[model samples]
Target: MKRKWDSSDERYFGIGIYRPKTVENVGSLWRTAYVLGASFVFLIDAKYKKKSSDVLKVWARIPLFQFETIEAFIQTVPYSCQLIGVEMDDSATPIQDFFHPDRAIYLLGSENNGLPKSLKSKCQELVILPGEPSLNVAAAGSIVVYDRILKKVNRSLLIQ
Candidate 1:
């Protein structure tokens, strides 16, 4: 039987990078995502080499989708999922203030250049982590995921 989606029901989220520059970062992010309950991980316009940092072999536990272009990635976003872009843009909402959606795909940009205007335009919301100099892409993604988990837990506590 098909079940209807409910906001209070189990929620799922995924995190990914756009044109990621290093294999180690990808592996680290993948490991963290799996540990933090991400339903999946993905890459857009990038490829990753196997890295030892991913000792958990998270790839076997969760799915990783690779898309050659932003459009391709956008097309595959699950229905009712929001695209939350993590960036340092001035207009972005601080991670602490941003209420994560029940279903979301968090997209982080490449380490050096960050997300392009074309891609940022497509994001439903842009969020910024707390920091001055830019953070490593993997680290930024980890923080975002951690924030989401933390907020979700806090909300659940309130409800209980």
Candidate 2:
């Protein structure tokens, strides 16, 4: 039996950053987030940086929320959403092997420090990329988004 197409797999996930150090990286990641079907993009402790790039200029289409702090952000996460921290903790599982939650808020950390302990404590799962535990913050986010899209692109979703 053929399954009907499901947009459900494409729109539930969100991508976020924890005080990203550079505007360019965040901008690039935001553009990729839109391509990967993220419902929206958010920033923790965002510096209220000015926009320059074409991607950064796009706010009307993809909403960008800036949280004053991680605590405030945590409080706002949807009740059904699962927070997935992108980190390299010893307990963290490889990204390739980890199963993405249905409603995921994929969180990337600062370019210099990765995720703060406070934010890490709030996440239900931590994922590390294969071989390289630490990647550029934007790269890490792009990879996660790519993984989610790949997971959603199964036989049923393919065109005949």
**Which candidate has the highest TM-score of all?**
1
Error of 1 at 94 (Å): 0.7
lDDT of 2 at 83: 95
Q: Return the clash pairs for model 2, or none.
A: none
Candidate 2 lDDT (Cα, whole model)? Answer: 0.83
Point to the candidate with the largest lDDT: 1
Instruction: Report lDDT per candidate.
Output: 0.90, 0.83
Clashing pairs in 1: none
| Candidate 2 error regions (>4 Å) | 1-11, 155-160
lDDT of 1 by residue, 1-160 (tens): 6878544586899999999998888888998999999999999998776665566778899988899999999889889999999999999999978999989999999987999999999999999998799998999999999999999989988887
Backbone steric clashes in candidate 2, count: 0
Error of 1 at 141 (Å): 0.6
Q: Tens-digit lDDT track for model 2 on 12-100? A: 88898998888888888888888767889999987856475573455766888999987899998898789999988888888778888
